[model samples]
Target chain A: MKRRLFICSFAMATQLFFAATLVLQPARAGSEDAKSSPTEVRVDNFTFSPETLTVPVNNAVTWVNKDDVPHVIASNDGLFKSKALDTDDKYSYTFTKAGSYSYYCSVHPKMVGKIVVQ
Target chain B: MAKNDRFDPSLSGFIEHDHNNDGIDRRGFLKCMAWAGTGALCVIEGGILKSYALGSQKGSAIRSHKTASFSFVQISDSHMGFNKPANPDVIATLKAAVDKINALPDQPDFILHTGDVSHLSKPSEFENVDQILKATNKEIFFVPGEHDVLNDDGAMFRERYGKNSKGQGWYSLDKNGVHFIGLVNVMNLKAGGLGTLGQEQLAWLEDDVRHLTSSTPIVVFAHIPLWTVYPQWGWGTDDSTQALSYLKRFGSVTVLNGHIHQSMQKVEGNITFHTAFSTAFPQPTPGAPEGPGPMKAPAEQLRSVLGITHVNYVQGRHALAVVDSSLV
Candidate 1:
């Protein structure tokens, strides 16, 4: 009887340890997402959230559109341009060299954003 | 003034931009009144100008009047392949527009597709618009709306619709003594800018009209509003004032534009600026409290702009591939 009770407790402890790891896995991945990609800009209501962002060198930035209307993310100096992003569509660009890059919506030029890589 | 008697100068500044106090509210009211005055047919007889309200009085005057030479129908913003709650089937509405154009007692000489001919600049979208418009059997003239120049920057648009057009799809046609200039203002837009006619296009426009006699009635068509309607909404063109200066010598000038999705009109001196309704959906009129935010359509025939949005995770995706020449 004593042996059986001990075995049951040990099994429950292992199961709890594994379950805790399963729950923590996504949170860990999310933090890593924050660390690696480091930046996210949202296009909403005809404006870019964080209209300006600052990040370290070699970091990637992703612009996700939150508007139903299509928007194109284009750099001012003609360095980079993205395809027309539909609702929930995203375009990612990495900054290997530090610089101040200005961008705007090619479709609606009134919408503008900037990124400063230091 | 009554719809039938629109020529009376008492019409107020309906064709001009609304003042700050009356901007959206009054124009919002006209959206309803437009049902009564869908198209304004005008004729210059002897020395005076006469206007006809198409929907209200079926213009027996135009038929009986011997001076009326030619007429063309304008349909703007087909937005083909747009399947949204606002308008699930844009094809049907375009067909209805064509039907109305054909049903006119005097068959129009041609059709003017003022832009937004496609939803995403997809080949299929352009192809679909082409196949559907064949029912009209009229020579269709086109200008590239911002929507039409997506993807490859209007290369597809120029290839399909701009055969005889020069540089950026601008061209002039002389139809029944009316000099029609289709300008391309939806190109190479700078950050925080309105629609632009580049320096090259401006020079071209200057020379295009230099030789025409002042008596020749001029019709200017473009994708964006040449006159300032709402700068905050990007409803106006940036270099249009310069473009208009070239036309000042002319006695009669008509500017037809499409982009706002709802129709509005203004007459600044002899230049009549008019915007046409979109065939796919209706956007909320500008100057609303919430601002004209990202086509939040609703109101007019189709209330609500028909879209929702959320962020997407790129998941370690690489930077996108881009080309130098796009969005002309």
Candidate 2:
């Protein structure tokens, strides 16, 4: 079991290393207005836009609530959770490890999303 | 709108939408009301269902007053502090609800706020609701909606609402020979989005009703609908079946819930599940194109879509008669 876990981490580490190079690059001029990275998720109309997101290890991602109702983001595992994000409120999390993550709005579980930390 | 369309809130003067109790029977009456868009007061006298539309009743549920031994109002999803296009001034609408409750023939024994007393779980939100609900001058009981427990895992909600309750605020009360069990199912929600009444609460539920006789009438109030209204929308509870199994021996079980933000009713054998409307806003029906959220009803019809439920318990009756009254 330990060996298998190690093998999985090694694979993820390689993917994370490659992923880092993609996001670690500096943004071209005027590119800030048009995000070059998938670092933000918007909660609107009881849904997470870009239902799936991928980022490199240690990359920070933020979720902003644009809807009038409040929403809570909670990871499937006992990992990260957010306080209720009311309209125009935001919560951010930085992934430090490489793996697949699943989350949903605790207030409305039907609104689900995923984050792939490579 | 069609002339006879039942949803017209403009209708006036005590209209009994369906008075042919002889043909419909209780089962058929429920089947019809389950699809009814307007509010109704259904009185079960001697196992027959007699219903009156609230659009004309003004608030009194007058027909059932004679047979009802006691009545309590159920209001859900007040969503205090909700300032969306749906219903900009939730306070005004909630005050309207208080007015409707106060207008009833005999003041309901108490009020059951099924859940969502606050929109954002903020202290101020709860306080605003407290101030508005105080006008009824009736004691209010609560179960927290998922929205209520969002911040601090419901620390603020339990502190303000369920001080003497147990385990994330689940408790049971006995009043006038009727048993009321308040359950909490919004804490520690599981992934894939479904309501959960964890093992601990289920165990407590089993032990809670152990002593009641089979003749007892049980009313279960919670934030989420226990029956599977639409699992795709996370409208149902994961472990509610087990919690309900504990109450199977009882003659009648009525489950009142909120969070769907629309009125819906379902009957399954001995159990009847009814969901109340939000005093603040309406929501889409199950399986709508956009998904469920604070639905924006046209301003004029907003009050008609939002409503409260009145449940009357007649001594020795097979079931409690439920009356849903709109804020208008």
TM-score of each: 0.75, 0.83
TM-score of each model's chain B: 0.76, 0.87
Q: Point to the candidate with the largest DockQ.
A: 2
Cα deviation in Å at residue B131, candidate 2?
1.2
Q: What is the TM-score of chain A alone in each candidate?
A: 0.70, 0.68
For model 2, the stretches where C-alpha displacement exceeds 4 angstroms are A1-38, B1-38, B44-62
lDDT score of residue B314 within candidate 1: 13
| Per-structure clash totals for the candidates | 11, 1
Q: List, for all models, the DockQ compared with the true complex.
A: 0.42, 0.57
Winning candidate number (lDDT): 2
| Share of true Cα-Cα contacts across chains kept by each model | 0.62, 0.79
- Cα lDDT of model 2 by residue, B24-129, tens digit: 2244434333323455766544334456665556334454457667889999999887887777899999999999899987679999999989887889989999
* Quality of model 2 by C-alpha lDDT: 0.76
Residue lDDT tens for model 1, B164-211: 899989999997677899999998998999999999999999999999
lDDT tens digits by residue: candidate 2, A9-48: 7545644543343222222211232235548888887789
